[model samples]
Target: MDKSNHVEINGDRFVHRLKELTDAEKQCLESQNMRIIPKLKAAKLEKDAKRHWDIFYKRNETKFFRDRHWTTREFQELINFDPDERIFYLELGCGVGNMIFPLVEEGFSNFYFYACDFSPRAVEFVKRNKLYDDNRMKAFCADLTTDDLFDSVTENSVDLASLIFVLSAIDPTHWSHVATVAYKALKPGGMLLFRDYGRYDMAQLRFKAGHKISDNFYMRQDGTRSYYFTEEELLKLFMETGFEIIMNTYVQRRTVNFKEGIDVPRIFVQGKYRKPLEGKSISTCEG
Candidate 1:
């Protein structure tokens, strides 16, 4: 861990908690700067969101995003199992195999991976990756916010389901449905790995006026949208949807401009939520 990114919560190094900052940093947070929804077009754009993401992939061709190399570092349990142990892994919004490929290539190959995304192009890229193997990994297109993940896998077959930076891309109003699907796809005692944009993050604070779709929700210039989540909201959502939070903490880092000698802190909330040994039925939980 870099010294600048080091933060301890409750005497634990990786536990998630809101950060306390100096007066200057606090002033820089700018949590009160939500913009007005300039045009109702944002609503229509959000409704037709699949098109925007499809176009985003077409134009960028996977160049805009970097492969995530931090999953194993942050979630040691994913790679700590015996080499022969059988694991069923599902990653919602698996994008371009950033989390999946690294775990498999770097010694977590004893698992069956089911990765899904809404964009067909993104799914194709994952399939075309040289590291992707059909026998061990399956990348498909599905929208869990409105569809069940089990449509591509057997019920309760997954050991771990990850939603890395994916949930916030969805419309906030539909998150309950997404949670229900994730819970349904996992076996009893299965875990859901979550890491997403935290409230008052630098990215959230950088949004311009007229792009706001809702409080802490905004449509970017490219038509894709995001929601900044607070820890309280995540806790309530997980507990109500039959999850018990195991490791909950925030990751914060300060980036400096050496020439100007200015620093800015970036915050992201990460958590591990476990399904109960006796799980809740979708009917009762979603109700």
Candidate 2:
């Protein structure tokens, strides 16, 4: 069973629980399929993706996203490693060190962290954090959809890699490239952890028609884009990139606030994949 608990942020208690979506929620999502952003605008958004993310970080700094403390609990591989064992852990699209900092604070000294983001501002934020140690971690800017990640992280060298809420930020057409790059970066038997917005997720359903860039993909008012995923499609993406699926499923949660009289159901897809211990080298690029 998935964990459900009451979390208090800024003194207001929010209850989160596992719950299926109600019919009304399903209807709202269906409504989003009627329209999408115009082609020229969508193309421009894709081309200026990095600039938008740069502005996002410049405006929000490190306040928008909370540090991720749930990863160690959700992914046992993170905590299973020996404290002194040397493991190369790579975080693709690591925004502001939200995920890596928590692990460092929790005493994961065994990890040699390599983190990258599309926005240079985001990487600067990570580097400026007090906990960032050059000897233990390398924070850089790289677009996973291209060969930039390979320039910093050698092929077949990473022991663990994570794509937490990262893939959705990328355009679906280049998803194959992201997977291929990750596949090439990991050592045989290395693991990749993934979590991202799921189809019919609250955020996806909330998008007005004009915001839709394509099916399950949308642009926010700030110009940043998101692509919601289904468990089947996400699994197929990594599998076709030559990864062995360990687990893949949807995580459903309901956020409820009594004072605000608000209740929203959220959905996310999470998965774990591993490179085969013995196999031919995974090929680069698909179509």
Candidate 3:
């Protein structure tokens, strides 16, 4: 199929495509299309995300993402470190220290958290947070797509790193660069956890015609942008960059409204990749 062009799905064209498709394939396509409404809503969410930190901090400051109360449960379980060991945690695209603040307050000290984002607003927000301290937390603004993270983090020093819904916002072509940086920055056996939008996700099907900012990328009315990914594409990008997958799962979450009699399904691909220990083959384990 020609990915460059959009698929038109009016009544006649839809019926034609249905005739050509097998029953199972037709069902899948219908499922994907069912996400159009949610996708449109999510697209509108992009505007708020474009100058996300700026608008958020201006109005609410650090209180916006303060629900870091959930970070220890959601993020900490992925770390392979002992709480007593001095660990280095780096969050690429760490906007406003949402995860950092929660982790610190959870009493997980003896760790240095290096947080960075490309947005200056994000950097300032992190710096201004009450939990931020030079001794334990460091915040900076850097574009991970093209810049070198080594200037901010020592090579092979990080014990745990997270991408957390950040990479899908970047141009897909730059995913390899982001993976390369993560590979170089993590210590042997260190973990890289990722959570991002998956292909056929409601967000992808919501795009109206002519919304293309580039192939596989679209801008929502809200000014934030997102790219969708398949498991195959995501696995290939990380593995080719010298990391081995440990856990890769396509997570499906559905929100149901009884009053509206509608079900909103959201899909995300979450993966954990680890840098190989010296002399250890990258292929021996699976993510």
Candidate 4:
């Protein structure tokens, strides 16, 4: 077995709380910002973000991402419902069916999944999967930043929306639009589950000078971009978008390679927010 790829969440080497960066790590981050990507290059990357992701899938296919077996563990909401209750679940960036197919195999027959991705190649991969059933899942390609998710998903009809590792890949300028789209597609009381990279994670610290694209955002070696978020800013973004925060916090995990004797910290921001019921009145004073 390959212990080299082992990743343990809240593992023995790391605490679950927010990680304070060491002086060296802080200095490395400062150095990363010294030579940012040129304006012309940054603009072109933003304009052709979809193309890069399409190429990513064209090369890696479904093999790049492992099936997400941790969804139920992290989000008990998936199993909290009655076995017979129909869940109109939407996965905002369902990459190659990595997150949805596992649920299907787990016998979530009641969830009718609507999965979308920015890359057409990724969506096609989802559709071609052996577990994909027309009755259980509907996979398509849509740029959540600009394309209307409601074109395929009915407005105010979704029961749950998961944006796992999705928002970070988008430019900060369009984040609000994506949030608004998710809110519109969800029922008034529907929940949105989000998990994304957090500030000063190992990956962010490793980037060398010249990749920075605005504050806390950078381009990866493959041309795909990622933005690290602070929990406060992320929560504020959703709250301002009309979601009432249920929970928001940073999660620290460790990736360990015993064979190679390596252990590194990973930081992520996880949140759950709910859309307030329409026309619900608030009382000024408590009883």
Give the per-residue lDDT of model 4 (tens digit) for 1-287.
Answer: 12333334433121224456789988998998889999899999999999999999998988887788888877788889998898999999998988889999999989999999999999999989999899778898788986567789889999999999999999999999999999998998898988889888899999999899989999998899999988778767887888878767776667788999999878888788788899753211100
Compared with the true structure, the alpha-carbon lDDT of candidate 1 equals 0.78
lDDT scores in order: 0.78, 0.85, 0.69, 0.84
Evaluate residue 143 in candidate 4 and report its C-alpha lDDT on the 0 to 100 scale.
Answer: 83
Candidate 2 wrongly placed segments (more than 4 Å): 1-23, 256-262, 280-287
RMSD of each: 5.1, 5.9, 9.7, 5.4
Give the Å error, residue 86, model 3: 0.5
lDDT string for model 1 (1-287, tens) is 24454566433244344555456545544443444665467678767888899989998986887777777777776876788889999999988788888787776768999999999999999998999899998999998777646669787889999999988999877888888889888989888989987777778776766777777788888989989887778877887887877765566656578899878766677788888787444221210
Runs of candidate 4 exceeding 4 Å displacement: 1-18, 281-287
- Candidate 2 least-lDDT 10 residues: 9-18
- The candidate 1 region of ten consecutive residues with least summed lDDT is 278-287
lDDT by residue for model 3 (128-175), tens: 878889999889877787655777889999988989888987766678
